[model samples]
Target: MNAPVDIAKMLQPRPVPAAMLDALKARFGERCSTAQAVREQHGRDESPFEVPPPEAVVFAESTTDVADAVKLASQYEVPVIAYGTGSSLEGHLLAVQGGISIDVSRMNQVLRINDEDLTVTVQPGVTRNQLNNAIRHTGLFFPIDPGADASIGGMAATRASGTNAVRYGTMRENVLALEVVTASGEVLRTGTRAKKSSAGYDLTRLMVGSEGTLGILTEVTVKLYPQPESVSAAICHFPSIDAAVKTTIAIIQLGVPIARCELLDANAVRYVNNHDKLSLRPAPMLLMEFHGSAAGVAEQAQTVQEVARDHGGEDFQWATTPEERTRLWTARHRAYFAGMSSNPGCRTVTTDTCVPISRLASCIDKAVTEADEAGLPYYIVGHVGDGNFHIAYMIDPGKPEQRVLAEQLNDQLVHHALSLEGTCTGEHGIGLHKQGFLVDEAGAATVEMMRLLKRALDPKNILNPGKIFAL
Candidate 1:
């Protein structure tokens, strides 16, 4: 493993020449700033390492503004880091190349909601919570709920997915089209509103998870699902981890269309109990939700209950009321943050691996055992139904050796997952953190093909550079 450098350093802002700063000030006025506070906010993402910030932050208020900034950036030969909700888990927003930071928050607006077509067109800065609140009265909802109130563009860039992913699928599936500003400042639309097509190259799909490298996603069109007719959620306790894994695998094999099937280890349960102020037992637990018509949900719940019973699972304490369900899901969504709160003055290091239903148990079993042996302070949680899991490590930043060990263990977990014909990342795209593993996961030829495509789209490397690829 590479020797650990200081990964927790805050982003440092680069200084632009007076001529450039004056030009930017003339161009954007109050929207552009060289102040340290603003630059700091624009520089770092939610990732571990912090690097140099851009010379200035330019708040672009519209797609045209973004195109203008890109044109200026192309002329200046400077880095242009697209900023969204600042919730990325990788070092995606770091201005490693040093130039201008395009803060997209000002551009937030819902362009269109085609109820008949069941899709929404939104600007890059519109957040998930904001979008949901806007459409709350419409009876249709966007279902890709990543933990944070992340921007749609950022979520698309990262290819984020969460609890609902088991039911609604990830950005890769929901994203129908994108309006993008290329490296050369050309504004183009990739895909049509059609649900399915075999017409041309899959540019829409390609741009969905590009992490703002090939192009800056200015606007996005995503499919929406009709609100669930009947929604029911519950918590199920298991006697052991093995029992929980076995039951999860059984649910998948039985083909139950559960909306969410998440596993929370005893440690994670303890974290939530402390953070959310709940008094639940600290055992391996499952937080599940089922959606459908009343009769269908009832039948599915009954079958699930039976399977749980056979696997040493406990009672299903249901949450029927909207408030109760919201409270429950809110707790689940902040499970990792809750884990972090359990340790004062420490940050979280997350590791995720996904495998097939047949190998899920083996992958998680070994990971837990390895974490235990390493004496790591971490909590295990996951969307277990899809055979994917995450380990949230609350590591002390003062200790570099420990962080290296954590990374090594994570590498091993990825190796194990890949051994089962799984992926290193189930939802999180191959940002800077996962770049090295991409080659091993997708062989040399495939990696070469990916590089060629990236080159074709972003020959200048002015978009999010040094992400996924070494260049």
Candidate 2:
């Protein structure tokens, strides 16, 4: 016998029962919102994709509040998705399931700064720049940067890496612990402030990149770095991009403990110099930073210069003043926007991937060649030390054939990464955009296990549905 379709049971506009609404109003008062504008705005983040509006938004102010809200959500059978600073590159915050978005921004408070232990405890909504600024006077700094001012929780959830990842590592290394609210409304503490442990499960790591599929992160304890005593910057130019990329590969193979190693292709250079109104070499370029004692930094800078010179790189230009370095990196960080500016009236499709350091030059060369052959407008750059880069292709979405060609090129790049024993995504998690590709990257059994975990934890299949996988 066929099961009843339940179309009428599910389709009748079942609004939130007044009892649940009353309970929420009691707890949050005006903080609970049903306003269409606010609900629709909370429904999505930075993803350039389609998503449905959420039913409501809750500005959570405490872990206890989070627990209470989740308990109610579980009882009411309403989905709950965690919201931090809406800055994910992937479509992580899309509310396809249509439920509640637990806005954690109200919980943005730095609770504890254990300078002795070199760790800090903070509400999940605390952003990288906000945390760093708070700790600046303490002679300690948090270094997990992701370009934008993303929340610590979001960064941890995505295993976000950025230009400084070459030195400090990603959220994988920085996050020491978490306070998570399980799907069943249970609060669990994972990991600890201790540096090393043989602790079972490594639940901390499991939660680090969960992306709200497994549980909701409420608070984070992160490791901190002692403020470097001295830092120096060096900018060098190469005759060609291949030469610049080759030099970066050599630096990594030679094992330089330098802080930052970023590459900006000639295209990126032209855009930034024009947009930011700064005079810079319109050639393949590498900007580096050395951190340590003055003597040690000077020596390392010299060593890097020698390596670059051997690969047809130019003289190393130094930027010692804070103003100089900031101006340089500010220009570097805006490289993506600059790429968009290269061609007026266009949108950017910023696709990212990582590879073994040895294969970077070849990978980038092939990708660039493919783009050139397709006659697409694009710019490419990355943290060369990590063998990860983004090719921001500018195209008119209205052009049907061009969109297809862009996706074709993207697929080719992903296959290239996989063939080289690298991941399809290095920093950006497998959100909706890369759902189909995750299986190819992790294999069927691995993806199945991931799905099984998702089902076991969120049996209702209400949390961020149709994301990463579909029924």
Candidate 3:
């Protein structure tokens, strides 16, 4: 069972020596901020946890700035948390161990664009949308969208994936190389632009999902895909979530090559309808997209529609124009906010369990049953093509019992996924929230190995301390 997080016990803020603060202020001048507002902003993320803020915030404008700030933290034996757009939902940015935050938003820049090779090098602060806009004219796009306009650095750090991952793969596959500032404040580079390599350690990947525990990502190089010549988006209504899930499973099993296959239960659809001001049918639905040549796109759409029809799907609708497609997806991406809005002053305990395609239906069915029986306000949505989905349980923060019930539901969901040979978290990394689940998924020995790696690299244990697993 999942235990509630105790803020008091976890707020073991190590004293940030005044000398270190003075040193950082002297080095960075106005860029170093000790303002409570700035530190509070950097300390919390989208996660529900509320802990004390970091002692200081450093606005890093370049790799050199990050390195120097980290150097001071390393010298002072204080935790250094890397801050991006703070869109992470796993509490990855909280400064539980009190130190300083190095905000990378100022480092926004697309350093190099190799349109010929289909790769781009960018500073950590560049957002996914910004990256796509910068390369749109080159007929290329980065497809690893994590729903949020997350910073490139944060995405790389969390090894994020989204609707596009079913075809384009996650950050682990798209990211080619990184310029990192290590625990000791040394610059390290990993991987190359070449497609494949037999390089020694695969350090690039090792750092990808470390969640800022090992090093700080300063620059990232990621592979890009050509813009689809022919694209089509469609939605189909199903009698129940079961029907929609079965359709998705059939599509994937038959190798339909759907670019994006998303599911939104009746609750999710209603919330989105209210928030986006669209009168979509409040039923379990599948929002799908096809990308390829004209003939190829048509064929894929036909196959998927046939599959849906066999599974009791109806009201298949297409969004033909680019603007229409954008509007639909924009609504989908805002589903989380929509859910929150529905419950005025509520926080959510969201599950990121991902099972194999075969077990998705069973996994989702049991989760839905339990959530409904619990009598809690909840919504279900997912990138179901790849067997990943989210069930967000909205709970009033003022009610302790509601939080407990939500956590219980999440605990059961995660354990069931693990039992079915799935992951506790598919895209979200093990921040403070999922440490227990990580241990349950990866055995004690395996977790110990991870701890060893963390110790080997960060001997001081000052980089994003109290995350993943306590050292």
Tens digits of per-residue lDDT for model 3, 219-313: 99999999999999999999999999999999999999899999999999999999999899999999999999999999999999999999999
How many residue pairs clash in all the candidates, one count each? Answer: 0, 0, 0
The weakest ten consecutive residues by lDDT in model 1 span 2-11
Task: List candidate 3 segments past 4 Å from native.
Answer: none
Off by over 4 Å in 1: 1-18
Residues 1-471, candidate 1, lDDT per residue (tens digit)? 422333343233333557777777888899989888899888887666757667799999988889988887776666688999888776788876677889999778999999889999999899999998888778899988877889999999888888888888989999999999999899999888899999889998888888888899999999988888998988899998888999989998899999999999999889898999988789999999999999988888999999999999996798889999888788888887887788987767786878888898889989989989999898888988888799877778898777788887888888888989999888766676777678889988888898888788777667776677755
Give the winner by lDDT: 1 or 3: 3
Pick by TM-score: which candidate is best? Answer: 3
Clashes of 2: 0
Off by over 4 Å in 2: 1-23, 341-345
TM-score of each: 0.96, 0.93, 0.99
Instruction: Please report how far candidate 2 places residue 328 from its true position, in Å.
Output: 1.3
Q: What is candidate 2's lDDT per residue for 1-471, written digit by digit as tens?
A: 112112222222224556777788798899899899998888766555545667788989999888888887777777777888777766788666567788998788999999999999999999989999999999999987777888888888888989889889999988889999888788999998999889797988987777887788888999999988999998999998899999988888888888899998888889999989988989889999889898989888888999999999995789999999999988998886777676777766667889999998889999989999999888878888898888877778677567667777878898888889888888988776676678788888888988898888788665555556564
- Report how far off residue 381 is in candidate 2 (Å): 1.9
What's model 1's TM-score? Answer: 0.96
Indicate the residue-level lDDT of 385 in model 1.
85
